[model samples]
Target: MFNNSIPTFKFLSYRRLQAGSLCPMGCNEDEYLHHISNSCSKIKDVFGHLNNWGFAIISCHSFADRCSWLEKKSSFIINLFCSTIYLSWKNRCEMVFGKTGKSPLSITTEAIGIASSLVICNHQNSGQLVVNQQDLLYKSWHPPPPDWIKFNVDASLLCSYKGGVGGVCHDHRGRLLLAFGRSCVHWDIAHLELLAIKTINEVFKDWMLEYNGIIIEGDNINIIKLIHKKIKAGMEGMEYLSFTKNFNHVICNWVNRDSNKLADLCANYAILSSFD
Candidate 1:
């Protein structure tokens, strides 16, 4: 999956590519975050709301400069900034993947809603207000068994039926082995979660990963229980049978959504992405 020939990595040295200084969008110019946020005909609309929020979207010379500005902002404003950027990224993915025609205004609305919810949650957790103990959950990601790599997955629907799923694999010491997010047009979460597992399994296989075990974790208790039973009974479906047959140490477990935050974040990322 590591394509060294192009700028596949997020921090890739992209200037050396064959396309050189031209965007794939045919702008005949380098595709930097500045161009993406301001000049790209495909995604310029995605940043329109930034002007309404008093942010000079095109003023930042680089992504790091924007980060520096965001770092000085309040939580509410930071949420808005980060969420808008994330939504814009997702829209870019959609355009690249040829799933276009979505309205920028609608996406802006969703980004605002998500940012407001995050602000509210931050306020509740900030301890300035009394949050009910019964309603508050402080679940944190836990390490897997000593030698296992845990894969946590989550899926959510946004913008009415567009789905995204994401998963991450971390070793016992919390070292990330892999992470992926994918977007789909359907809102069938049950299907999406399972698809995430299958994709993860394939990646592990392709990488020829050396691990004592692979633990699949997610928030769906029923699916967790079912997978566990299938593995135990040696009756795992075709989707997972290859995994069970190849690896003697595989596990399926349920985690609270809070504990699976990384995976959930991946899923959120996926909903706006077009790739694994």
Candidate 2:
């Protein structure tokens, strides 16, 4: 319904509903995504609330620009923005259908509630509404938790001792805070991978006096699922997982390799270092 292609009354051009394209606010412009979202006299106040809250993308010139800008923000904040737009759209529909109307303030309040619910429900990994930017669709990585530092770690195993381990730590905005890489002897692949986690954990441990805690990520889901086990099958990782208590808190998560690309690149750098 948010896209321009929809046959809103204004776009349909049927003479009986000739007034359809015209905004009820009498903006004299065809009702489009831009009109309902950031313009139009009926529901523009929601944008003000969103902007004051530092969404940093409402000022963008177009729907596509705003979508790309929102890509860099946290999921909670993005849902907050989405809620505002949705509420505004609903209000517009109600008004047009001659139903009792809701003020923009009411809509904004509801949108904020929606955002709060998203956070409370832990919808951090919920799939996003895919919007096309121009002719193409694009998706990007997500940020870490609010006020928490994150570490992405990976290791490249080789039969040769040229095995490498590395990690990149970043803040909630995905800005690089620290990165480290080194050459290491190739043991079993799982053993070497656990060493990479240990190395990154050590980095966070050293910063224990500065930050509150850290969230560590890797692409190995099987081992991550087994990391907290007391059994011997998890021996390679359980040793390092037990070290979490040394910090304020430590969260271990498995990410797709795409999200872990920066750390994978760091690991490759270590492999090259072995030859140097």
Q: Report backbone clashes per prediction.
A: 1, 2
Which tens-of-lDDT digit does each residue in 150-263 have in candidate 2? 778888877676788887766664445666677877667777677788775455555544666668888887667666453335445355455565557667788888777757
Model 2 error, position 73 (Å)? 23
Q: What would the TM-score be for candidate 2 when compared with the true structure? A: 0.44
lDDT of 1 by residue, 155-251 (tens): 8777588888777776665545566777887767788777766666555644434667777888987767767777677674556547655565777
- lDDT (CA) per prediction: 0.62, 0.63
Worst 10 residues of 1 by lDDT: 1-10
Tell me the spans in candidate 1 whose CA falls farther than 4 Å from its real position. Answer: 1-139, 205-208
Residue pairs in candidate 2 whose N, alpha carbon or C atoms collide under 3 angstroms: 10-20, 10-21
Candidate 1 overall lDDT versus native? 0.62
Question: What C-alpha root-mean-square deviation, in Å, does candidate 1 show against the real structure?
Answer: 11.4
